[model samples]
Target chain A: MTAWQTKLTETFGDACKFETFRDNIRCDVRTERFLEVMKNLRAQGFDLLLDVTGIDYLHYPKAADRYGVVYSLVNTESGERAYIKVRLNDPDPAVPSVYSIWKGCDWMERETYDMFGIVFEGHPDLRRILMPEEFTSFPLRKDYPLRGRGERHNFPTVLRSDG
Target chain B: MPLAPAAQYPIDADETPDHEYLYTLNFGPQHPATHTTLRLILTLDGETIVKAVPDIGYLHSGFEKLGEDLDYNQYVTIVDRMNYISPICNEIAWHHSVEKLMGLELTPRCKYIRTIIAELARISDHLLCVGAAALDLGGITAFLYAFNMREKIYNIFERMAGQRFHPSYTRVGGLMFDVDDGWVSLIRTFIKDEFPKAHTDVARLLNRNKIFIDRTKGVGVLTKEEAINRSASGPVARASGVVRDVRKEEPYLAYKDLDFQVICGTGGDCASRYLVRMGEMNESAKIISQAVENIPSGPINIDVEDKLTVPDKSSTYRSIEGLIQHFELFMWNRRWKPPVNECYGATEAPNGELGFYLVSDGDGKAYRAKTRPPSFIHFSLFPHLIEGHAIGDVPAVLGSLNIIAAELDR
Candidate 1:
């Protein structure tokens, strides 16, 4: 096992399921223990939080949960990347925020909440980041239509050359 | 070193005991310094900003959603608009991620050509950032000098990929087409003769100018810890002395073989960021020249029978198998399919680490396409940097970050 895998398994024991595919290492942790794993990773030199994005596995039949939050972490010194994932069930599709660990997660978590509707518990300010404040739909959800629900048309056309 | 005249005097200290002393100022949604629709709600005490809340999302076009609807190849056109200043870099980054997911190995010629194009894009991008930052601080001559060099680079792009700005030049398997000797010579001339002169001219005009130095020296300084904690990348993090460049570390495309230096700045200020960008332009020139000189003479794309490689027009017209392959590649129902897996691929974009997180479901189209835009993270640091500094320093810092609005709001 690589140092990252060792570090993960040593920290979380059997709670961490480490897997490598095509040179990318991903560790699966439950939502309850996700924050603890992230804190450990940060302490273990995963200084850069590259990205925090959530995936909706509504169509995957084998998935145990409907939502999966992916945290792409990078150890800048070693140029090694680690991805930590936590699955959230539909009943409570929320996970603890990592804003305290990495300040970069502030907007990233909000964006995830805005798109996937997966709440980041304890996020300082969680709001719709890429959409309007009044917009009620999570446009990135699997059920959401690509053309949108006529909400885009409701806005006024402000610019027209003919006018 | 001294404060601006307005900041030297205090505002209403005790005049309004019942009222809020700090007045709010909406910096943008259409401000010149922002260059795009980025609104910062600032609570100002006279000239110094006490708090800044960046209100973004005006330019969000739901491109990520569109990625799910479009096929692997069809989404390249959409990715071009993410970072308009360096659209080719975005194209390369998107395809690099897609190629990684599909396990596509590019030809050596394609790799070298890609490195050259990407470096040219970087030079143009940094030139624009430095020039515009200088212009934002009342240096128009530097802007013109920088733009003139950028125009030469545009000519090279026009020669290679028919379009100057949105050159959807990169296809899934390889480039749309290959460049000839004329394009190579033009790029060589730009690197050898034109770009350096313009770079020097711009540097001479603003590098030691007292006004420029004073305005930018210590303005919006981000400590190394803050830069790393906030996940700042590219020149922004480098200026803060946090060593991380995807090109140097990740070694994508032809960067592993090419020789170049990673410029760093210790100041962590606007001036430091500016110097880092300027030094990077020089290094980019060096990399481009090296790649151009060592470009291998071979097929630009893989000579494969896969659906990812579009069949040549003559082959499609002459051979029945080519016709069938072409139809199968472009047909609505039957196209290239990806495995049910997810992959994250990133490149050292001019701004920072522009990453693409793709989730495929064994479909022709992506199930989930998430863009990890560096500008989004860089822009998040705006509120932190703008606070406790004079409002005038906003442009200097914003320019240093080079937060492309399209990428930030994508």
Candidate 2:
């Protein structure tokens, strides 16, 4: 095991479920320590924030959290990558912003906010990035209706080019 | 730091100042540079952009929400639509994520086929980028030349997969169907004949054109550190001399076996980025040529049990085992349930690093599926790059980013 893995195993032992897949160590950090783990990972040389996004898990039988915010980090020099997951309850899905550490997380975190309504506390400018501001509700949430209630009737008129 | 000329526009002393607060200029939901239905609400100070807050869900089709409703196998089609310009990348990324979770290894032949098709997709995507950049730079003829070539690549996709844009040709363990006979010969001919001519035309039309160079050179320069810090990948990062390629860094499919140079540019400007992509397209052509000639002869799919392999022709005509396995593979294949873990898999998408982070609950369906769309990140740097440049250069810079709204919104 590498130093980062050892440190990760020591810091969040048992609380952090560690597994290896495709040569990348995946650490499922406890929701509360998600930010701390990410901070530590960055200090330990995982400087690149490759991706930050969410997943909906409403259908799973024993799903502890209704949503998951997946953070993928990589050390550019060492080529060591880690996937750190933070699960959130459906009612109040939120996590601390990693944007402070990774500037790339700005848009990605906003995207998560846009799709799944997972708020990143302290995100520089958190807003709907891929949807109309007037639109109500997060579209990527599992319960969110794919086709709005009788909204098909509103399509022809509402869908006019915004020009 | 040279102040922009646009910043020099003087406020007239005689003109009556409106008492109204600074107005927010909604740039899109239909702006030409937005590429799709992206909307950016920019609070402006006269002509200077003050604060740019992007509002994006116009192109959202409830993909993640839809993922839950659809079966595992059926979801690949939806994934293909996420990045419409290079649907194959999306398809393969989704497939690899699920495959990783399931701990399934595809046959060598399947990997080679995937590599070939993926390179074709890259070529088509780069052609679109170069062509669109030229069009944005006011060279309509270059756009036509590039689009004509793109059409040929699309035709190849159509002939092979029977779909033009969103071909859900990739499956979890292998391809949805094997390549038809003589497809290799057709691809070989395309690589030898059509591909070079198109590239030559693109180069001749815009590569070093004075106006194009003046507009693109030294514009939107991202430093190597900034590119890495911003998690930029593919051509955008490569253009900045950051030698990070998912294929080269962490090999997948036949990338480990096949040989190709990792193209890089030290300039980190729009021109450098353009050249990098052009070079990459040529490299992709070479990879495809190599793949076609040396493709191994074997079953395209792994020798998995019937349940995980292929579906039966008709339920009424098939035996009970076939029906059971079909249901297992299609509807409820617990055997293919991924381990209770998470995996991040990225590919060299046309825009950048198209990665998929999957969380598996050791169940038939994915616990969570998160996509790391390159365009979304690349577009984040847009305001930063376009801030000080001339307004005329916005479209050229935007085109060079090669953002497909589907991926951006997804």
- The runs of at least 3 residues in candidate 1 whose Cα sits more than 4 Å from the true structure, single-residue gaps closed, are A156-163, B1-19
lDDT of 2 by residue, B72-102 (tens): 5788998888887778888888887777767
TM-score of each: 0.95, 0.88
TM-score for chain B of all predictions: 0.95, 0.90
DockQ scores for all the models shown?
0.74, 0.62
Give candidate 2 misplaced runs (Cα > 4 Å): A9-17, A30-33, A56-59, A65-67, A89-93, A145-163, B1-25, B41-51, B311-324, B331-336, B361-364
Candidate 1's residue-wise lDDT over B128-159, tens digit each?
99999999999999998888888888899999
Q: What is the TM-score of chain A alone in each candidate?
A: 0.92, 0.87
User: What is the lDDT for A86 in model 2?
Assistant: 78
lDDT (0 to 1) per candidate: 0.89, 0.79
Cα deviation of B120 in candidate 1 (Å)? 0.4
Shift of residue B216 alpha carbon in model 2, Å: 0.5
